[model samples]
Target: MNDTPGWASPGSAPSDGQDATVPRPSEPADSGGASSKWSAAQPPAGQWSPPSGPDGTPAPAPGPAAGWGGPSHTGGPGHNGPHHGWGAPPAAKPGVIPLRPLGIGEILDGAVSTLRAHWRAVLSVTLVVAVVSQIGDILVQRYLLPAPVEVDPNASPSEALDQAADSAKASLVALAPSLAITLIGTLFTTAILTVVISRSVLGRPVTLSDAWREARPRLPQLLGLTLLLPLISVAITMVGIGPGLLIGSAGGVALTFLGGTAAVVVAIWLMIRFSLASPALMLERQGVIASMRRSAKLVHNAWWRVFGVQAITLLLTFLVSLVIGIPFGIIAMAVDGDGLGGLLSGSSPEFGWPYLIISGIGAVIASAITYPISAGVTALLYVDQRIRREALDLELARAAGVPGYGSDRPGHGPTGG
Candidate 1:
């Protein structure tokens, strides 16, 4: 008994004693924890009861709260998720052409798409412009030109020259007011149409009256911008050309050539830069000076792009006009036999109602197709600028009711897919 370990005794349990040798019910087994024991005692995974709360009611499984994801998170088809970059189009592929450095083809494609989408608006605006242009053309053709004076065949050469010069001066003076009116009307109309087309392309609401209202305020600025070219021409002519011609007549050919070339270059540059001024003036609601400035800014980095697009548009328009005009011209020539001479001779070409009607119809059709193209291009130019400056593509998509990316719904794709 004495040889036994001091920590053990006869009356006490062995070193591995569990409260006098019997395991205590309250103590957990070393090999089996409570959770493990419970799990083992419970049914297998398939046969187990659904998870329950402490109160014994089943707990809800995790899922999207509504048809889409939870309100806090974007989680649906077409919903650009949290990871999307700001001002970036979700649908836009990476490494494609950047929007900032837009190419001529992109601009033209945008313009064409706009026209295709909003043909009605484009047609309506074009019709109005065409009607006004045609009426103005007719007035100028019929009423602005002076009647040729009846000159005696026996009149002296000097007298004939004097009479012709005087007649020419008088005709120009008489046509001035009509010309001014026509220019003003055309500029105002074009400005309004440009605004309408721009708004339409942007998916903004616009009515004819609204377009007119929007354009009215900018008319003064537009008129100022429009007058700039003629004013500059007049100034250069008065100060440079007039003086140059006078001096050149006295043996200063260098001055004349230099002055003329400078004037031509300046005029061309100004015209090219301001070609998009009407659209800027309309869409931006800018003052004439400001609109001009804005146009200069927008065109600065992309002058060639603007120039190319405009040139292409002009060429296309010219080709279309030729296609239409050639047939009409041929018909007119056929009807007039030998053409202008025969028609003006005693043969007296009949101004038949049918001819007038056909010409009018042709004009309308041509206008319908071409007007939209021009308007749409201008609108697209405006859009391109906004896209460069303001990330307008995102705005446009939002306006088009595209989903996701901080829109009202969560978990929706950017394109509302």
Candidate 2:
């Protein structure tokens, strides 16, 4: 027998006072009155032990020690025993958030907490990725536009044809490398950023270098996940002449209504199912398939909650973008209406300094603000599920190096028994 503190052992009871070694009367009565029969029933400290069987073997041990303040009575406060200072009242089960519906405020608070704790990792990864993505955007735009055919009004038809051929050759040479760099940079940034955000939001410590390292191995998987949507879109387009006709038709009332509804439903489901995938990948170090499986399991019955939170986050991000984008768009329109129109119509203006600078700066600001919120909310939701399902609050407290049963802390419940 290990003789460790088995649950059945008559060990020192929980402390009622700071110094709880001192024994007190088992029952209360008048000061001078004879002790009650109940007082006599409790064995003295030194003699207390479980009743032995006829063969003198001790009774089997009770279950593992209950936590200091769990819902069940393990001879702790609010039970039929002397109250203790260390153990919470039976009513106070630590680490269990009440099973009330989560509100927007609670979700927001969790997000803020996540950002405050992991801002360094989050900001570093986000800024790096955003800059890379923006650079890629610039490169693709500047050098990748299809060459315009040169038309010489004074030249004969053959000479004009020769000029157009030369222009086409020049355009292909300029555009190919720029397009490749842009695609590669965007892919790398998305994978690494997803891992970084996932880990940071889950209350784990992750460095930017470490995130990049972890993400590298799973880059292919992330790329596959990224491309899955576009491939599906392409498939849908190929499925019917309806899609092509919808595009040409001015009012796609029936098609638009059906497609929009279907898109929203699928989007909601994907958001919920994959909400935990990034954290699973980063923290559990699983590949994309495994992480996705784990995420699907965790989110099985929690789809609505996930959908609500993600939808709200999207709304928030959209509003923030609109606030910044609307003004910048108006300014851009006012400054160079013709250039804006030309840009929209897929015509490149002569490459200029001012337009790029303003657009680039606005893009960066919008990305920075919106990226953290979206990432933070996902992380918070992951934490909230762990707390709800696996008693993760206590584990987190232990990780944070807080003592059990100390004063309550904000953003956390007490330790479970």
- Candidate with top lDDT is 1
lDDT of predicted model 1? 0.54
Which residue pairs clash in candidate 1? 74-411, 75-411, 76-411, 77-413, 78-412, 78-413, 78-414, 79-412, 79-413
Model 2 misplaced stretches (Cα beyond 4 Å): 1-103, 113-120, 141-207, 213-216, 229-264, 334-337, 340-353, 405-417
lDDT of 1 by residue, 1-417 (tens): 111001011122111122242112245565554445444566556776668988988988765434343112111112222323343333431111222325567556665655665556556666776676655655554555565555566767656655654675677676676667556655755776676555554355556666676667777777887888567665764565455556534344457667778877676677667776777666555667766766776566567767777888888877887788678766655554444455668653544444444455566567656666665676566556545433434434443443442352332222232
The 10-residue segment with the lowest total lDDT in model 2? 1-10
lDDT accuracy of residue 307 in candidate 1: 74
Q: What is the C-alpha lDDT of each candidate?
A: 0.54, 0.53
| List of clashing residue pairs for candidate 2 | 67-417, 95-414
- Across 169-201, the per-residue lDDT of candidate 2 in tens digits comes to 677677666555544544555555455544433
Q: Which numbered prediction scores highest in TM-score against the true structure?
A: 1
